[model samples]
Target: MDSNKRRHVGHRRDNTVLPLAAGVAVVAASCLTLFVKALLKRNSKPTQKQGKGREGGSAPKSPGAGAYVRGMREREYVRLIPDVEMLSLQSLLRRIQKARGWQFRDDAARDQAWARVLATAQSAAGGAWPLDFTPNDVTPEQLQALCDAVEAEFLGGLLAEQVRRAGRPRIRVVLGVDPRDPYSWLSGLHEDNTIFVNSNRWREEVSQDNPLVFEGALCRSKLEALAHTLGHELTHAVVLNFFPAMDASSPAYTPDDKHGPVFMWLNRRLFGHVGHASKRLFNT
Candidate 1:
């Protein structure tokens, strides 16, 4: 009996040790990845080339999505929830700061800036904003909640008309992370009427561009980036009439052709330019 008990204890230790070792490996790998990314950013120079797909300016090609359907409801302009005419990241931040008399100082002002983001999110979400220190910590469920709030508050008005005309529910926003592609800002929409937001990419971008911001403050930048990506994908969903898989199979299709002038115009009109869509859109 004592021998059997000893054996059981040994097995428990083995299982515990395995998990601990795996956790260590994961931490070490994450550290290495951050170090390498920092080194690359430090050494790299900004390129002015357009349409070449650079970080912060372009999205990866859509998965399982055929070429863009040309001239298909591209001219249709839908109503927006926000009353503002032009929406840019800077403008959004500025409006919030102005309301509270907050000024951007050096890195020390990060908390003040972050407060504005939370205020805006809480207001827009009607006090249902999920608070987390980092995007890495936020679960997919929390993200979906955020998306639901944004859709309900900012884009809810369009949903009724969309359903009325199309006889189906509005396009659903699904949150997912693609840690493998660290360079992408946002993975383009898929054929499943779901929008994938790269939380991993968002973390990398925030760490690289806003080093001073950390902890909960980091979430401010993440939310802004999320806003941009959500608007872009939502435009695609609406334009495709909430059914991307079917619409994309049309014979007249070309990769990235969905980003033509008409799309940009409609995006601007519907949600305003929040983040860079491509090299052509540039940083807004």
Candidate 2:
């Protein structure tokens, strides 16, 4: 993207506080505290009766016993911790508010929030998900491979043109595992082009066919979550590399400014949301 497309017009008055940013900060802090507890809960052994439904009722019986069993298992694994899900919704709202300068007093007033997000994502992808954007199912051992696949697929396609247009050499990003951070599932360093993904904070088991829903958005699965994460970090790399003027290192940049319009647009296309999933929960 060019400077005109990436740059934001109008400025905030000096020392003015943004409520959306404050909201995000509050949610981030809460997520940090709850994330630790979530990790502990994930690591603890589960009881035999843990396979119940979302409301703690018995699993539904069906004529197709195999399908019923699979559905139960998927339901068991395809969720984030409750607090994490709530925080993710808050984070998504903050991002929407930041991007559109929208304010919502209640859920009724925010009816168009997700529609706006999807519109932007679709617009970014020329009215649909990118042709090369194929998110696959993932197992615990396949996270790194999934990352590699996303990087290869994206860079091998339109993203490569952006790099070439900037007169940059071929781009390669390093992927690392972060087991220590309980709050963030993924983070990146644009300077070194390194992306770190965390698994310790996720549930012990993941479902291949089920999607984790946050707010009204879908992660598709653990594979899709990690893929979207790579897309998110890679957006940072692309923005920081090609659009130096939008670099987050500057002291003057706001939290929203760090993930600028291009970042939002690209990620929205990649993941169908302007935000990333940072944790997972097992249905308990």
Candidate 3:
């Protein structure tokens, strides 16, 4: 009886010890798993921070785009014109600027300039120029909205007519605002592509005191200063229309200086005027 009781007590002790040992093993395993997970999280923190720092550090390198945005933001003018005339002038300017690889300073200025130019060109082409030339103090968003309206109401019909008149290459006008420089310029990027205008100069040239001036006083009397600029730029485009390969480096091409009579004749025949001939000539 004593031996059996001792045996029973030993069995009970073995069962309790086994279960305690198993519980201790499980606890140890859980602690090790938590420790490993914490270690991995700690190791990953520095890499993530480094990645975020890199992304943040590399954002200010696009100065050109920044300048463009700034110019757009400060734009304060809008002009509207009929579709037929605007599209025709836009098409021609697009051809000229492309051949020269020129860029502009602001979209608002360009659009306004175009509106002026289109009206003048239409008048010159035996159509009536629109009477509304009042400057508007508008935001970039407003200017864009006006552009959308013009595109829908006037540009489409004008573009279609221009295509019919000039043959199937599509004509597009792209306006840009550049804050880094303050000068308006125009470009035609190939006959098929688009016309680009920079309006930096337009804003400065057209103020309350001086108003805009253009091409001797005679043409100035008939066209707004902005319109005259467009005509001159369009002439550049027209010149390219005939001599598509005439580049800045070409011998036939003179600088902005005034060239001699022969050069003037060539220019007038090809480019339609002799305004900068003297300067281009002396420089050449």
Q: Tell me, by lDDT, which candidate is best.
A: 1
Best by TM-score: 1
lDDT of 2 by residue, 26-60 (tens): 99999999999999998696654664533323443
Local accuracy of candidate 3 as per-residue lDDT tens digits, 1-284:
99999999999999999999999999999999999999999887756344321111221222123211111111110011122322343455455344323323334434454454444334533234323332233233332333323332222233345455666554344445433332434222344534444443333333334443332222322224433333343344433443344433323233332132223333332223334411211000
- Model 2 lDDT vs. the true structure? 0.43
- Estimate TM-scores for all models: 0.43, 0.37, 0.32
Task: List model 1 lDDT by residue over 175-270, tens digit each.
Answer: 456444444546566654566765555544332344322211222345555644565666666557643442464222223446643354445444
In model 3, the worst 10-residue window by lDDT is: 69-78
Model 1 lDDT, full chain set? 0.46
Comparing 1 and 2 on lDDT, the stronger one: 1
Please report the TM-score between candidate 3 and the true structure.
0.32
Tell me the deviation in Å of residue 162 in model 3. Answer: 11
From the highest TM-score down, the ranking of the candidates is 1, 2, 3
